[model samples]
Target chain A: MHVDINSYFATLLQQENPALRGRPVGILKDVGRTCVIAASKEAKKLGVGTGTSAYEAKRLAPEIVFLPAEFARYLDATKRLKKIFSNLVPDYEIFSLDEAFLNLTDCTRLYPDAQEFGRHVQQLIKDDLGEFVTSNVGISWNRFLAKMAGEIAPKGSVAEITAENIDHYFATTEFKDVCGIGRRLEKRLAHLGVTRLYDLHFVTDEQLETEFGPYWSKELRKMSEGKEPSLFAHHAKNEQPKSVSRSITGFSLAKDEAEIRAVMRNLIDEVMYKAREMQLSGRWAAVSLSGEGQHWWSHQRVDMPIRHAQELFDILYHQLYSQWDRTFNVIRWRVVLSDLGSWETTPEPWLPDWQRQEKLEQAAQELNKRFGLFTVRSGVLLQRPLIRPEVTGYLGDRQYVLGP
Target chain B: MYQTIHESIEVAGVFTPGKFSPTKFRWGKKTFAVEAITLLSRERDGLVPIHHYSVVASGTVFRLSFHPDNLAWFLEEVWQEGA
Candidate 1:
């Protein structure tokens, strides 16, 4: 079963403001400086959607209400909805902030009928999350079909896909309806004479492999049959991510090397904070800068697993400074720590000062945890306005922090 | 239009069995009865817990923030209808 909220952030805004109900509304990361992160149904009718610039959105919908995103409030709503799902099924995978999939193979027998069960789940969400908050529920044998069903389902409704109806659904659906086939892939498939989901059935495996890689070709074949790829069988389990990154956007390009270094320091602080929270260490550190019509990325594989933010910063500083050109203004900066492993599996440094440095880092972590983030941050971060961190969604490399 | 104003205010609410819900508040010389609590959220300011409330009163919505550290209430924002 797949449950998805409708216009998640924008709907939440309307749910909070009665004046916003039935009106075009869009949620922005900030009022003056960011793009539209989410748009309400009314706004969508005006051709305003996520990724639309605030200025463009206003031009499209003159009366569109733009509200800053309240992530803490949205997260609170997600938590409440999660509790409702917990009551329905014991096993579920949270695909994103507004979407989740439940494994009902073992629990479907508890209900008299699957459609009734879906309705019950929808009603429970509405009852618990106010009448304005609504969801689409989709029920099928696997996650992919269920998600597709939910996407095609009407707002505040449920759609169930079974073997009897799967072929009919695919015959009418477009290639983009499938989860993995995005706009780029859809265009690629179009060039291959596979414009619809039904068209995928006619393409040979070798042809698909030649166009897309071997992995995606097999996945597309399975999706064409209304069957999920075998790799998604363990969807419910939480697997450790291979990399964690933090990035900042919307800011102008840094004017000098010092400004860039300060931004890098702050970015590393955010990544390391999450790494320590997860108790993971990485062997590769990467730094990327984008702006002024140029994009540069540099990375270094360290001799030892880097656990502290300072160590990661040291590697990135050397790699970035050596190649950085002051002529180009850097509008965005990103720091990534990849090749991760459990901290317990990491070997300790043999230097005499290693223990002392580790103790200092631990103490700093404790202080920041006791206080708020960056309460004990480096001096380099203090030269500018504090870079507030946010969790955009599950897809980005940004840190995901739950609760208050 | 939304205007930002962080000013101290007084709120009247009920403390019922582990929860607090504001019913009215006074800012300057005017008192607005909270018709509905549109949204309520809690977030941390450093180590201190801050409660934020979005309330609609007299056909307008106001964002109220409460700081537990000093037990102070702040009128954070005002959204006048049709503004």
Candidate 2:
């Protein structure tokens, strides 16, 4: 069973503004100044989403009001909400911070119906916490259709997807719309001239094994007709990244070597900062610069992992700059920390008193975490600076990686 | 009610953002003109400090801090002094 906190973000916005109750609200999104992420159901009905231009949203929904996405705050609320959810429901998996899945098989006897279970969850979250809780239950014979059933179910509703009705449902269901039938599968199915569930359902076991990987293909056949294993608690402990990458596509494209070096220097600085955040070090790097003449040049390096953020930047920039005489005059350039050079084993190396600089950056990250970015930066970063550029799209944000 | 904190920290500015190594903030030799503001963001369930930076016409950089402790006061001050 899955639960959705309906309009999770919009509800947060309304919670902040009492007068905005039941009114149209949308989060004015920014990827270094780009688009909105989620909008209220009202605004959504008016065609608002991640890519909806501000002017367009304004035109479509005149009553729509804007709220900036406070990721840190929302993260806080979700943690509280998740804890409450975990306590209330046994064996729950967080689907998204805003959603959860609970295996109701064990509790079916205790709770008479899925409806009652859903309502209890809904009320528990809304009453105890300050956010809205809206959920739908899909009692399916299996997982694939259950997920689909959950998505299409009306608000505050439930649907049964047992063997009896699974066929009827898939007969009209679009293959592309199915959650697991990703684009590659769709293409393969198209090549085989099989585009619908019906087309795949009757295939023989021999053909299935030969065509797709025996394990996954076999699993697919079972899931398609509404029979599959329940998903287990699959949360993997979050691992500190081996490498952190930050890229920028300059809004004002660089025309020459100097600008490219300036940007490359900044990119190295960003990647190094993230490495330090995770207390990881990188032994290898893949740095690339792209430019106007359809020109692109990239360099890869292997060295001992460096944790001192400033020194990492200094080494990378010095190398990247040497390579950029011709290739860095482009629209986009990036630096990536690859092959995590080392783990958190040691602290900054000591140098002459005057040469000591690494500890200062470590202090800067903590200070900024207390404050914000650029509160303190390497003096070199301050030399001939470049402003962050904006990204314009529904899916990709140029400015997303260039952040704290 | 909203007021603007005029301090403009260089974001995605001449320097790349988040590309710095030693990802934490430093006091360095000089303290900022305005201390970073600190707040316990509900989202993070921890303290989040924001350093507000602004630049003058002459390209000199000035910095300020924003935190939970000073959020209300900062908002009020911005409102009063805002253009």
Candidate 3:
């Protein structure tokens, strides 16, 4: 079963403010950002949606009200929603902030009828969350079909796809409706004169391999038959991250070395803080900069675990920034730490100087934790507007916050 | 339209074991009676948790936040008919 909140962020705002209810609304990532991250159902009907520019959205629906995203509200609601869902369905996977998948194999006795179960869950959400916030539930034998069913289901309704009705849905649905088939894949499939899932019957296996390569060819065949080979693989919870990265676009382009260095220091601070929070260390570090229609990126493998911001910054500084031509103003900066391994499992330090630095890092982390992040930041970040930590719309690091 | 007014304010409210609801608050020279608390959410700054209350009052929506560490109330924002 796949349950997805309808217009999650925008609907939550509507639920919060009575005046916003029944009106078109667009959600922005921040006050200054122009991209509409999410749109209320009313706004979507008028052609305003995610990725729609604020200017375009205003033109599409002049009466639309815009609100900056309140991630705290959404995350709080998700925590409560998860509590309600876990109580009823133990075997569940959080697909995103507003979506979840439940494996009802063990709960069949408790929920004999999946459709009834879906409705019961919806009622619980309405009762615990507000009346304006609604979810669409879809049930099927696999996650892929269940997600598709949920997409087709009406807002605040339940849908189920069985083996008998699978073919009917495949014939009626377009290739784009499938979860894994993106626009690029759709165009590729269309080039071969395949418009629907049912059209895969006409194309030979060799042809699919030639177009989609070997791995996706097998996946596509399974998708055409409404089967998901790795349906259970996504259920793995509390999995440590393989890599950690943080990137930010400057409010205005940085024209000099001082500005670029400050931004890099801030980004590295964030990356290292996250790594420390996860109790992980990286063997690889990368830095990338973008501006003036040109991009520069470099990465290197370090001899020791990249545990500190200063350490990673030193490597990136020598490789990328020191060699920079300074021809164009940089508009964005990104720092990445990959090849992660458990810091807790690593052997104890043997060098006195290294041990002293480690203790200093620990003390600094402790102070920052109590006073707030960046309270003990490097002097380079002083007097600068602290970027602080932020939650991504994708909720990619959900496992670090919520356990299985 | 909406306006951001992150100013400290005086508020009358009900405070129970686990509930904190503001009934009325004074901003500038006017006191607005909260008709309804439409939503409540909590966010963290460093280690301090700030609780926000979205309320309807005087034909407008107001976002009020409470700082537990300082036991202070702030009028964060207000939304009216137009800019």
Candidate 4:
């Protein structure tokens, strides 16, 4: 089963304000910014959708209301929605803030009727969330088919896809209707005269493998048959991160070597702080520099675990500076710490001053946690003010206050 | 349109035992009995926790916010008919 909230961000704003209900609304990260992140159904009817600039949206609907994106509220609503699902279904995967997939094969015995169960869940979401918030529930044998059904389902309704009706569903559905088939993939498939979901059945596996790799070819074949691989059945938690990176843009571009080094140092500190917070140490650090049409990167693997920002910076600073071209006018840089392992698994420090340095670092972290971030900072960081973190979503950068 | 009004106001409401939802509130010298709670959400301003309430009263809708740190109440916004 797949459940998706319709125009989730916009709907939440409307649910909170009665004046916004039934009105064209657009949610923005900043009202002063032109980009529209999400648009209400009314705005969509006026040809204003996500990624539409505020100017374009206003040109389409002159009376459209613009509201700043409130991710905290959206996260709270998602938690409530997850609680509602937990009471009915045991296993589910949250695909995004507005969509979730449930494995109802084991729980269907409780309700007996899958369609009725989907409808009940939809009603519960609407009643518990708000009258303005509605969800489309899809019932199918697999996650891909279920998600497709949800996309094609009418607003505030349910659509069920079974072996009996899947053929009919595919006959009218386009390739874009299926998940994972974005514009790039659609254009690639269109070049091979495959535009509809039914055309996937006619394409040979060898032809698919030629365009996509063997792994994706097999995955597409399974999706064509409304079946997902067994690996996707369970929802895994607490998976280790493959890499930790921190990069910043939208600031004054670096014009000199000092500015470039400062940016790199700041990014390294953020990534290292995150690593220490997670109690993980990395063996490899990579730095990427990008400017007006040029990009350069350098990577080095250390024999010892790199746990401190200064140590990681010392390694990358030499590699990055040696390759730096004075003409590029660097605008952005990224620091990535990879090949991570738990701190317990890494070797301990053996230097004469290592213990004193470790205690000093711990004290700084404690002071930052109690007072605020960067309350105590290295002298190098005093050259530039720390960049304000921007909100993305539940998984995005978060702003925390120190005291109650 | 949502407007920002940060003035502090007086609120008279019932605080039941073990229940945090306010049954009614008086603002602008007009008393409104909360017919239904449309939404209840919590957010923060710096270090202060703010509780927001969307409620329906006498066919009109009101948005209220309470700051527990200093026991402050604010009538954030009101949506009257045809406005």
Candidate 5:
């Protein structure tokens, strides 16, 4: 069964802050637009959850504690927890930072039942890690149903979502609550009057085929029937970020528009220069600005194709200042390059030619090699830097995120 | 502990310029700066941070170990590198 730890990050914050005990809390990431990634169990009891925006969470629970994410710390903690899991369950798959699954179907004799096995895991995590990690273990025939069971169960509780309760789980849940289901699919599924899992389960194969196409119709039916593809499995070192991003906080709310633009520019130049030096590019660039009283603004690259680092930076640099101007003091700024596209120097049809593109790439390389990545930068990026000699890049020639 | 890591960093350039790595941590989160950002459009292999005359004297290390928390974080990474 899947063991789901609700609001693991929020729980960590609450546990660390004695003052935040029993209070609603939200986790903040550099992606300021992503209101809330996780909320504390207390917040959930108040009907706040994963999709709850930070603004909404703040409105609901005015006393909510906002915690910035420190991914490195969480990674360290997860490793410690995983070590305990390896010792206890010979076969366990870490699903995410806060969840995992133990194949207890074979080890039924190890505990009285799945619930006891789950209890043992919960206690083990809390005791070993010295953190209160309440896990909801779902016992089912397979990994998919088991994970669903864990998710639907009450906090610090366990329930088996078998043929019996599977109906209840789907009936009471939204499309997104179903793992592997996304919004577009849900809306598409709705077109066939299959708005609920029961609707999908009861739909004839032909009707499903008519709606989702031949291949996916049966797949949707299988999912509705409480079956899933597979459990989270360990892979080689391939699970990593396609690109890296860096952002910072701390600017006056009174900074002028030009001053704000300069800061954004410095940040852009640093990231672009480093990305260029590293020979990496992404399909989407995430730019975010956070200000006083929990105000956060984010703009994804809408104009550029986001195929390369320079392109991503160019989009972010132009858009942020043009939009925010000097209206708000930049409490923080972040840049994330994601959706790593193909890494090749194919000739652009618009500006096609090996020589021209190579010439541009070569110029950037030479400037970086001579003066370090920061030595010579685009004038667009050198506008700001009220803060002298700012921090830049994971190291000399790279941005971070794909995990060094 | 401070002196140990300080030693692994190699100084380069004519005028006590920047530093280069004399040792590299070879595992898990201890990333090679080269492999850190797989999508940043870097044209080179890795980075050599320019410490700058101002930052060095500005006490980068002093600021790092300024508090017990920072010291603990630094020492742990340093220790983890070897272990």
Candidate 6:
């Protein structure tokens, strides 16, 4: 069963504010951010939705109420919902902040009917989270079909996809309804005359590969047959990642060098903090920057695995930024530390400078942990707004998803 | 428009076994009687959980927070009548 909260962040806000109930609401990551991160049911009906610009949303529905997101509340709600899942199911996987999958093999006897199980979970959510908080449950034999079923289900309702009903659904559903098929993939599929989910069933695997490459072709074929190419337990708590990355899209295009550097430092600080918390370091580092139709990428294999933020920043300055033409505006930037290994495997550096740097960072980490993140930061960051550690609405951060 | 103001304030509430019902609060020099509690949510700051009460008072919506660590109440935000 795939349980997906409908209009999650927006619904949470509506649940909190009684006045917001039945009203069109657009949630922003922060005030002044033009992007609408999520839209209420009422707003969605008026064509406002996730990724809708604030300008476009207002034009769609002038009466739309825009509110800044409160991630803390969302996280709290997730915790409460997970507790309920733990009690009801023998096993469950948290798919995202607004979705989870429950393996009902053990509990089948308890809930013989799919709708009954869905209603029971919905009631529990309302009782624990709030009355306005509702979920759609998709019941199927496998994960992919279950997620598709959940997406097709009406708000606050349950839908099951079985051998008898899947064909009907495939014929009626658009190609985009499939999880991995985005606009680009949909366009490519259309070029091959595969316009619907039903059309995918007729296409040969060899044809799919020619258009989508090997990985996607295999996945698409599996999706077409209502099979998950990956294991059902893909949503299970992931092991310590091979790479730790932090990326951000600026609210506006950034042309200034200082602003770009400040943002880069902030992201590096976040990446290092998580690595330190997990007691891991990386030998490979990569930086990607893109904006205004220009993209640049640079990566290096360090002599030693590095975990300190300052050292990582120095490497980036000397190797990456110093080489950049600085011709294009930067709207998005990403920093990745790959080739990760546990601290137990890392050999101790013999240099006195390295030792002193480690000691200084450790002291700063202690202070920050006690007070809050960025309580102690570099002078360069002092002039910029402190980019505090914030959980994504998608809840993709493994460290936070796995929890303490 | 809602304004963020993390100023410590005095709150009057009834403490029951599992719930805390905030009725009124004193912000600056004025006392606003909470006509209704629109919503209540929880947030964690470090090890402490702060209870936030969205109360409608003074013809506006005011978000009041109770910090258990300090046993203090604060006026977190206020949505005014007009932007």
Q: Give the DockQ (2 decimals) of all models.
A: 0.53, 0.13, 0.62, 0.31, 0.03, 0.49
How big is the positional error of residue A90 in model 4, measured in Å on the Cα after superposition?
A: 2.5
How would you encode candidate 2's per-residue C-alpha lDDT over A188-266 as one tens digit per residue? 7677666766677777777777777777576668656665423321231232344566676665567766666667766
How do all the candidates rank in terms of lDDT, highest first? Answer: 3, 6, 1, 4, 5, 2
Question: TM-scores, in order shown?
Answer: 0.93, 0.63, 0.94, 0.80, 0.53, 0.91
Error of 3 at A273 (Å): 1.1
Which regions of candidate 6 deviate over 4 angstroms?
A231-234, A251-256, A291-293, A329-331, A401-404, B16-19, B28-38, B57-60
lDDT of 3 by residue, A23-121 (tens): 999999888888899999999999998999999999999999988888888987887788888898777888788988888989999889999999999
In model 4, what is the error at residue A105, expressed in angstroms? 2.3
Per-residue lDDT over A1-404 for candidate 4, one digit per residue giving the tens place of the 0 to 100 score: 99999999999878877668999999987646678989998999999988999999999999998888877678767767877877888887666678878788897679789889888888888887888889998888888889889998888889999889999888788876788677887898788888876788999999999988887788777877777744354333344655788776534457777777777877777777667767788999999877888878889998988888777888888665566556677877888999988888887888867667677778876676555456666666785867433334333222111100
| TM-score, A chain, model 1 | 0.94
lDDT of 4 by residue, B3-69 (tens): 5555566666566884477678776677778887787777642445578887778776677888877
lDDT of 4 at A97: 75
Ranking, TM-score, top scorer first: 3, 1, 6, 4, 2, 5
> What level of docking quality does candidate 6 show?
acceptable
Top candidate by DockQ: 3
**Cα shift from native, residue A236, model 3 (Å):** 2.8
**What's the TM-score, to 2 decimals, of chain B in model 3?**
0.91
* Model 2 / residue A218 / CA error / Å: 5.9
* Residue A394 accuracy (lDDT) in model 6: 61
On a 0 to 1 DockQ scale, where is model 4?
0.31
Off by over 4 Å in 3: A229-235, B14-17, B28-30
Shift in Å, residue A142, candidate 4: 1.9
Which residue pairs clash in candidate 1?
Answer: A253-A330
DockQ-based CAPRI category assigned to the predicted complex of candidate 1: medium
Q: Residue B64 CA error for candidate 3 (Å)?
A: 1.5
Ranking by DockQ: 3, 1, 6, 4, 2, 5
TM-score for the first chain in candidate 6 comes to: 0.92
TM-score, candidate 4, is 0.80
